[model samples]
Target: MSDAREPVTGIEVPINLKYEFTAGAALARFLSSIREGRIVGQRCPGCSSVYVPPRGSCSRCGIATEEEVEVSDRGVIESFTIVHIPLPGNPVKPPFIAANILLDGTDMACLHLVSEVPTERVVVGMRVQAVWKPREEWGYTFENIAWFKPVEGA
Candidate 1:
């Protein structure tokens, strides 16, 4: 018998190959804060460390966390980077920004977007604030807050 193979079908599709955890009541409640237009962080009473994602425990303190703190939009840049590539499903363009935003009132750093300023001007210690989108576009992700911009008149 001959060993000829059959021809493959037509379309080559593009798909996002990554996924996330869809469980946990604590995580669900944390995500809901975005839709409510608020930045929620949980602090570890044992170590007094804060987490922006508001996890159920604190690694540094080795204890559970439940104190939910409403964080401010204003923060100083602890660290930052200029991304030359795009993440799958990323709404912004390449060579934009990806920064570790340390919220003003907490000892935590969360990754976030930086906008309204050229990449060349972003300094390590510059102050910035959340530039939120319209209420209609709020969601359960970081995109809920549009981006961080340089503090006005600074």
Candidate 2:
């Protein structure tokens, strides 16, 4: 046997996943509102807490959320992170800000990308507004809002 060992080589196996998602009634309403450039949430009758991208029920009170509430597109950043690592299939490059935004009138924060401002400038309580894609490209998806950005004069 030779003292030298053979070098190991590896091959990349690409995997693709495709599936159809059936949205419940509450989620369907949320998605539909998103397509129309409106952000809607469901209010829990018990606690009156509003949930964006409403999950059909209130986590706190354990009751169905049926009242649709329109929330402001502008919000405050509750927390955020500056991403430096690349994520596969993500079109946005590194050095992006991912933030949990507390939209006006909503009790829960939603995660979204913050752009059009310096990463270092992003901070908790920073005011931001949705930067929506053109109306022509509207679809039944959250992608309708391309990203959020710091609101001027806010």
Candidate 3:
């Protein structure tokens, strides 16, 4: 006896709600950090780069970041680009400012929202600080801090 096979045909399927890796240590740290009103990052002693939201290991050095670096609220704006398109899931008012900030004391730069100042006022060397949101609305997301604001001095 032999078996027959079906001819080649392309069919599209949709993905519905499904279960997944819900929570773990990383998530717990996120919750804890928000409640304490601080931005924390993990660092790899090998490469000397700190990561936001903390990571178990370093991507470049291939080692664990056992040290937790308390990043300064202020950082220098390394680079940025103006965004003219508005897409779904973006809560910011259109024509907002987004940039890569080389945070103080860390060798890495992270992308985040820039605000509290006009878009035209922003520059590459601009110094900005982390502006935290109210304690009540501190969720598990990075939005705990509303945006980066221009620092008063240094």
Candidate 4:
């Protein structure tokens, strides 16, 4: 009997996934607020922590966050990195700054793009503000704010 056999090789399987995502009440409210050029978050009654893009409950206290807090587009960079590699579907070019921004009046930091300044100059605690797209381009998504930039003299 022949003992030799063909070597096993991997097969490429293309996946096509389609589904509907219903952003529940908490997120729906957040989306609506952003659509109107406002940033709103829910305050946790238990721990008094505010969550932007508000999760329905508080991670620390495990309680419902009901109080809506309006936060400024301005924030401080808690941390950041200068991305030098390009992503497959990301529109933003490489060599850009991506940051974890602690928006004013919120306890948690949100991820966002930083621009309009030299990458070498971006630092922790640097104040930045949202640079929104034209009003006509506003939508129910965070993309409405094109990116964040350093706030002069801040």
TM-score of each: 0.82, 0.90, 0.77, 0.89
- The alpha-carbon deviation from the true structure for residue 112 of candidate 2, after best TM-score superposition, in angstroms, is 0.7
- In candidate 2, list every pair of residues with a backbone clash: none
Residues 100-121, model 3: lDDT tens digits? 9888887778888898788888
Best by TM-score: 2
Model 4 residue runs over 4 Å out of place are 1-17
Clashing pairs in 1: none
Local distance difference test scores for all models: 0.84, 0.93, 0.78, 0.93
In candidate 3, what residue range of length 10 has the lowest lDDT sum? 22-31
In model 1, the Cα lDDT at residue 14 comes to 84
Give the C-alpha miss distance for residue 12 in model 4, angstroms: 5.4
Model 4 agreement with the true structure over 121-151: per-residue lDDT tens digits: 9999999999999999999999999999999
Ranking by lDDT: 2, 4, 1, 3
Worst 10 residues of 4 by lDDT: 2-11
